[model samples]
Target: MTNATRISATLPPDLAAFLDEYQETHHLSSRSAALAEAVRALRDQNLQEAYQELGEAQRSGQETYPDDNLDGLENE
Candidate 1:
């Protein structure tokens, strides 16, 4: 299992209500779990964007990749 970290933040009333509903409907244990999942999702999105930018740079000849096969791996 992955290790976890604790964090705290303030949420607007509407957002808090939505989170509460989401937890109850999904049978999630706590607000921390929901927030952790949200953070992971956001981090993944950022990493994907960086990967896409690198791909674009390589395609435009602004950056060079070490191996041609690595280009195919990006799509997979």
Candidate 2:
């Protein structure tokens, strides 16, 4: 299975033009691949920020996950 699905999106004309140029410039297989790469990049960025927040909370001696409220949770 390719794990692919077709979805429709409404993009502004300017943004749509930009995506087309970006896809051509990067030689992506398709616009879907370009959008997927953009989504992956954003996902990685969000994960990085979340990890940084966890690290900061740990440094400040704050409970990233409160043990008192956690039920059926394993910390292994």
Q: Mind giving the per-residue lDDT tens digits that candidate 1 earns over 13-60?
A: 999998888788888888877776787678778777878988899889
**C-alpha-based local distance difference test score of model 1:** 0.74
User: Candidate 2 has which clashing residue pairs, if any?
Assistant: none
Q: Rate the local accuracy (lDDT) of all candidates.
A: 0.74, 0.79
Candidate 1, pairs of clashing residues: none
Model 1 TM-score on a 0 to 1 scale: 0.71
Assess the local accuracy of residue 10 in candidate 2 as a C-alpha lDDT between 0 and 100.
91
Which ranges in model 1 have alpha carbons more than 4 Å from their true place? 1-3, 64-76
RMSD of each: 5.6, 6.0
